[model samples]
Target chain A: MQKLGDFKLPQFFNYPPYFTLQPVRETREKQVQLWKELILEYCRTQKIFVIGLEEEFPLFSNPEIERSLSHEAREAFVSALVSDGRAEWLDKGHRKCLILWHRIQDWAEIIINFVKENGLEDSVMTVEEIRSGIESRGTELHGLDRIILMRALKLLEHKGKLAIFKGTTADDEGVKFSI
Target chain B: MKEQLATFRSQLEEFARKHRNDIRKNPAFRSQFHEMCAKVGVDPLASNKGLWAELLGIGDFYYELGVQIVEICLATRPHNGGLINLQELCNLLRQKRKHDREAVSEDDCLRAISKLKVMGSGFEVITAGKKKLVRSVPTELKKDHNEILELAQAQGFVAVDEVERRLSWTLGRAIDALDTLLDEGLAMIDDGHEDGKRRYWFPCVSSISSVGADS
Candidate 1:
């Protein structure tokens, strides 16, 4: 019943054993699955894309229970996510991770839907416009990470569904949708 | 009338004089003879003729209880020839000394042997084992060893070494103590089945009713 920023946490999130990496295989597998779901759910709802091991992550620690996942447990859960292709290590040290609540393909589909719904099938827009434009308001695309949005745009571009071009300004990038 | 009383007194005095010498030789016989003389109002010093007969009869039952106690102690340790050994008896004496240290004495084996014989119920004295032979009461020793052996048997198939370890004694001492009981025919040693190990047990002791589980 615990809520963080409109996301309802599962009952097991408060379980102390959830913080400790279980030694038994079956129990650990279940623990890792639960962690994967929670991490994806929290990141998707809160628009949280990056998780730094050194930095405080709300899901990793429970101040009420005075229990925090150790560094090993954090790596294990994140590694499980990476193995499942839902998250990736941002650095070789794995100190930071980029959670992909929506995989690049899924993101591309969302972009296609957004463009079609807005009646802008042939129109061009900057990468930033797709993230925070009025048309994208109240949608999952709003305030999304630029890097993730760019990655999703590049995937669509590679598939010939859209074309990406550099804008005149240093910060802006343009995207052209074909369909 | 005075002459008749005088004649009767002389006859009783003659009987006392005849047995007096034999009675004096055996204190028990002398006491019985003295009592009989007193009943007939005879003078013991005056009668010396039937003294040996009177002494033998009294001596027969004098230590009858003592003999029975020795018999029970012998039954307890049957290995010993109706005599309880010093070392095994010392162990019992040691136990007794704990509660009453004053009970300790070199003469305890002899006294305990005599005490059991006097009690006269299911006991005997026996000399136990070829070496360190001494007097012991088997029935009492059975009761004593039963308390300790029951505890050892509770472990189920206790190793010979384990018994030695728990008693805080070396293998030799444990075997020596056990051998005393064996000489009494209360315990047996089984060997040669496998690995050449000897297991000691009391077939009659019945401390543990279940056997196959340990085997």
Candidate 2:
């Protein structure tokens, strides 16, 4: 097993074929599936919300074997993720991708549970505060991406479980939980 | 003589009909049959509308094989150009003909490709030492190129110095042949040797196991 910054990588990460894009159809399909799983697992554990295609992403290359995914292979794996709704291309050029380790609906449910457990069901908190708040400490919600948090909050608000309103400053946003 | 020839023809027809299965299944038996046909002044694969063609359909058989060979060569041309090893070509042909009853041999492939020569595409088998390679393109391989390829067969590859020493050719002659082979994609250049000698590898003549290890 290879580890990247405390994130344990799978044994297949060392397999050379995992780095090169396979030309055979069946083999390529299996390779893509494995890459998708590894990418999602790595993102979820490392709290990585976005991946830049051209940037130095740790999971994309292995220095031990001196093998790295080509641009086409990166696009292929990310495209597979996009098709499955596990990831989305944030830029028109597909250079940037937003990985959704947890679906928006699942994130909303997690937020509701967090608020209930913290006794903030009827209380208000700034969007930034919920991300790094003491109440959310030691939880997956802590240090989460603001974009994902807002989407989850908006989902909750649609169900009449919360209300999102901007603070005095245009950049500052706050959420009121009716749960 | 005419009456004897007619009797011999009838006898051959009977022999062919009796051993038709053996001719198709066994390459040695098929070659023996071809020899017997030649001995009796009969050309089994001469034409599609002849008595031999009507009896054994050998002409049609080779014709079908020629079409398949063309297909395989065209399909693999992008990867290996028009030059392919006879064994590799036969393996691919076998894979394509998995459901067919006929077992193809190198002799069969040679015969089929020989038939393809009439189309003016320069289909022929060139011997590199003990190995046989099928060249589908019209590129005429001169004496120097043949010598180098044959010399490279001992090992999977050859250096220019080795070619010069073995063939007693000047450095320029060896380089010209090698450069032509390189440009034609028949040989691959390797510059990673410690002795600073450039190695030219012939993928067609090299054994599969050794190739895997080298790569």
Model 2 over residues A1-179: C-alpha lDDT tens digits?
Answer: 57898987765575444565654454456568779989999998888999999999998888885667889889999999999989889889999998999988888988989999989989999998899989899988999988888889999999999899989997579999999
Model 1 residue A11 CA deviation in Å: 1.9
For residue A170, give model 2's deviation from the true position in Å.
14
- lDDT of each candidate versus the true structure: 0.61, 0.80
Residue pairs in collision within model 2: none
| Top lDDT model | 2
For residues B14-42, what per-residue lDDT tens digits would candidate 2 score against the true structure? 99999988987888899889888888898
Report lDDT (Cα) of residue B211, candidate 2. Answer: 18
- Can you write out model 1's per-residue Cα lDDT over B1-215, one digit (the tens) per residue? 77866686566557546765554345455556556655656543332244533533322322332353343343333222233334544444444336532333333344344444455543444332232233333334644344335533443223467667775767776666666555554444443224445555442323221111111
DockQ of each: 0.01, 0.06
- Native contacts recovered by model 2: 0.00
What would the TM-score be for candidate 2 when compared with the true structure? 0.56
Considering summed lDDT, which 10 consecutive residues are worst modelled in model 1 chain B? B206-215
